[model samples]
Target: MSPPYDLVCFDLDGTLVQGTVFIWQTLHDFFGTDGDRRRKAKDDFHAGRISYRQWFEHDLELLGEAGATRDLMLAAIAGVRPTPGGHQTLAVLREAGLGLAIISGSIDLVLHRHYGQVSFEEVLINHLSFDHRGALVGGTPTDFDVDRKGAGLLEIARRQQVDPKRVAFVGDNYNDVSAARAAGLAIAFNPRSEELVETADVVVEGDDLRGILPHLLDE
Candidate 1:
């Protein structure tokens, strides 16, 4: 049965943006001797053992410990342009009448700054707060569950006034599998993860996100 979805949710890092692992590697640089700490914090966030805000603070403190300023963090992410044709594809998809959203595990530092380029209908991401002097502090919506990527989609659908059956989801990693399972169509585009490719209902090969347009809309 085809689910109805006038809406579509997208994953950020590996889906629209390219070279996502660089941020992870950068965090590792900040982690120093306790590199495993990064992974552990991520696991805790995903498993609901800790809130998203707490997990981000704990991990970013480790990242900032190396004196990595928030400016530098922003630059690292800003340097990341979307994958080939990503911007245009998003433009085309939006023009095609599909509601677009950005759901990512990336921090607000990145999305808050650059999300305008993509014009996502809604953006749900982690964040780190700061003071007037620009010192790192904490985030609101204090507790977020990273493992429950699917819940965000449901929320997005409701917020957009789009029917659950009308939504289509796209991603490039294992974390996205749950969102895919929950969406009307689960699409893996130029996917690097083998498991993700296997479970996807549509495998879009190559750089263009426009490829998935046919499935989500009629023109």
Candidate 2:
């Protein structure tokens, strides 16, 4: 039988990659950046006191002040690895002719660091800028993060010429609720939040990414 969905979008942290719930938090921890400041910025963004871009820029500024460089940031997340069966899952889905994309709040560095060889039709993530010496300079934040994740999913569907009902989304945290609700098939793999589990159509409890395959493909 044909696949149930035309496109599959994934969240980066905790979903595709293991060992980090949120890459931003990991970076802040590694750099010893101010936790209080980070929380304040996050609150401001949620409170409409700041835009997502402003919060992103503020985080980058904090990292830059702490002397973060491309190399160092990479080093900070060295322990992070792709989920078990992650590559296989992507490969199988690609082989099945399903469109694959990533809609994440995480940065590109983490994705490239682990799944650089894998290809996605669309990748919506933050971009970090660096100088010739590899020092962190500035960055572009994704608009489709947090509550906007669902919008990202819709955008991908529009671009792919697929109806939103023909798309699937896989995610783990509370932030994933919007996207999950927007998807035709929502799989909560190793979910970290009650909201996500409640929102998901199917829940896979494990570290292996292959667990989601049965829901996407005909057995």
Tell me the whole-model lDDT of each prediction, alpha carbons only. Answer: 0.69, 0.94
Per-residue CA lDDT of model 1 for 1-219, tens digit only, reads 332457788887767777664345554553352667878887887687987667667766776665555665665565565667776767766766667887777666665564565667877766667667665565544121234667888788888887766788888887677677667788998787787788789999876667777776654
Per-residue accuracy of model 2 over 68-165 as CA lDDT, tens digit each: 99999988999899999999999999999999999999999999988899889999999999999999999899989989999999999999899999
TM-score of each: 0.82, 0.98
Q: What is the lDDT of residue 197 in candidate 2?
A: 95
- Cα lDDT for residue 23, model 1? 49
- Residue 106 C-alpha lDDT in model 1: 66
